[model samples]
Target: MACVTGKNSKPKSMSKAKEWTVEVENLFRFQQAGYRDELEYIQVKQGALIERWPDTGYVKKLQRRDDTFFYYSRKRECQDFEVHKVKVYAY
Candidate 1:
């Protein structure tokens, strides 16, 4: 048998600045293979890279295009992909 408690747990809150930064990241979005996603940006500040996930405002539009060669290595090059822009979230 188990007993129930009536107390509620409190959730931790972050600073407003952190919340705003997160919102901005959510605004930057991208699409791949018909799937919409976000690409983040990292800024180097005070020896640390400020990282966030992008939202929807980044990509103007995504259009279906024929397959193009991203890169070619003489042997087994299909495992990796190429991205035009990327951010470093961690060191």
Candidate 2:
């Protein structure tokens, strides 16, 4: 819901989660050693947390690791589960 005016507009609590995403926006600022002569295929990395899940326990992060990529965190069921995101940039 974009906008809410009712009393129940918000939830009582939220859950932790890790989300991930991919994209290519900027390349001029992208500097790669392996792709110095080639163009940046696409970069990706950890991102931010939009919202928390109440049922599961997890955390979220959103960020741009490269000039043309982004990522998010996802909620893991296991407490010891390590969330790792990889970015593939083809030269």
Candidate 3:
């Protein structure tokens, strides 16, 4: 969906995720797409729509920096072992 761009859209701090959660999972997807997080994606894209699953509210699709799309399942895609690789951005 379209996001509102504002002064606080940029993340002030970031850290590696220590656990698996819906938010973390989404961040992982953004990371895979070469973005630090959703906020950065929105900023770079000028508020591009982010497709999401209706039922689970998980990321359904993402456009990478190369202009290619990456589709994700409604279920959790970030395994337990990969949680640490996800970066959580603080706005």
Per-model root-mean-square deviation over C-alphas:
18.3, 17.0, 3.1
> Each model's number of backbone clashes?
7, 19, 1
lDDT of model number 3: 0.82
lDDT of 2 by residue, 1-91 (tens): 1232443233334222243321211111122212211121122222233233344322222233344332223433222232222222331
Ranking by TM-score: 3, 2, 1
In the range 1-91, model 3's lDDT, one tens digit per residue, is: 2244574566666788898888888888888888887777777787899999999888889888889999999999899999998877666
Model 3 alpha-carbon drift over 4 Å, by segment: 1-10
* Superposition error at 89 for model 2 (Å): 30
Residue 46 miss distance in model 1 (angstroms): 36
Best by lDDT: 3
Compared with the true structure, the alpha-carbon lDDT of candidate 2 equals 0.26
Q: Point out where model 1 deviates above 4 Å.
A: 1-29, 33-57, 66-91
Error of 1 at 29 (Å): 4.4
Candidate lDDT (C-alpha), each: 0.24, 0.26, 0.82
Error of 1 at 68 (Å): 14
Worst 10 residues of 1 by lDDT: 38-47
